[model samples]
Target: MGKKFLKSDEEVVDPKATLEVSCKPKCVRQLKEYQACTKRIEGDESGHKHCTGQYFDYWHCIDKCTEVQMQSAACSIHCICGFSFALYSLYCMFLLIWSMERSDEEVVDPKATMEVYCKPKCVRQLKDYQACTRRIEGDESGSKHCTGQYFDYWQCIDKCVAPKLFEKLK
Candidate 1:
């Protein structure tokens, strides 16, 4: 059987940049619904009781939009670049492993390696940030409760994690 390639009906925006500006029709409809829900929530003082379900639906619509965008981007990259990027990534991974093995003569403590990579507090904060992202992956509307936590996490990574990790590399 012959392999099917690009969808003949799909509009190509930029073959080089792989960006699709127009979303699918269903996504457009869902976006309209989400916007209407938002407007209603904003206008009504007691809208929270009635709008929670709509908010979840809106969140799901946005999530689907993101999924479609990512899928299209991946398809564009694969179609344009083929296997070159994949091969390069594999080559880099090989070099990293080879270099690590070459330094095996020196006794390296795993704990020390981790400490050099990031401070203990930074590591905890990073984990918390990751967990928060995962927790809100399905219900991103809940992220408001985590805004301060996210800020702290990024601050730790910027001020403590990056410096330690870069210094260790040097």
Candidate 2:
């Protein structure tokens, strides 16, 4: 009369497997933008070659969107517990200061700058540098190796971009 236990090898199917998962429109849009940027980076062999600034811009966009999604999820939980207003106020203040700081520094569009200033010969080296950084970025080895990777990536970018800029300027 005891209930029979399924064997460990037996597959247990979820009843909700047919249900559709929906994301907020903003979240969907952000996901699309991130995907598009990733595709562009992957596709444009020459255009993004010497453009570390563009790479940084894309990375920042994805990071900001991810943060927004995380904050929105946290806000919902906080709202249920009556702390959402305080969190929202702090978030808004942080955004304002961040926006001001971002505006203080003029961001040069790297693609345009490279088109104007960099030589074609540097493209191969730039591509290699970008590939190196991309690999390091995906490394799961925590902060132990990240500091060295960061240094190497920046050094590679500098070597690839700086000389071309100086040579073109002169």
In lDDT terms, which candidate is top? 1
Over 1-170, each residue of candidate 2 has an lDDT whose tens digit, in order, gives: 55578899998864222111221232344456556656644644334223354456555544544444445445444545555477675775566556445532434445446644444545555566566666655444333222344455455556557766676663
In terms of TM-score, how similar is model 2 to the real structure?
A: 0.24
Displacement of residue 66 (Cα, Å) in model 1 is 3.6
Residue 162 in model 1: lDDT: 52
Model 1, range 131-152, lDDT digits (tens) per residue?
A: 8756754552442334556678
- Provide the TM-score for each candidate, comma-separated: 0.27, 0.24
* Candidate lDDT values, in order: 0.52, 0.49
Q: Alpha-carbon error at 144 in model 2, in Å?
A: 30
What are the runs in model 2 whose C-alpha is more than 4 Å off? 1-64, 84-121, 124-156, 160-170
Clashing pairs in 1: none
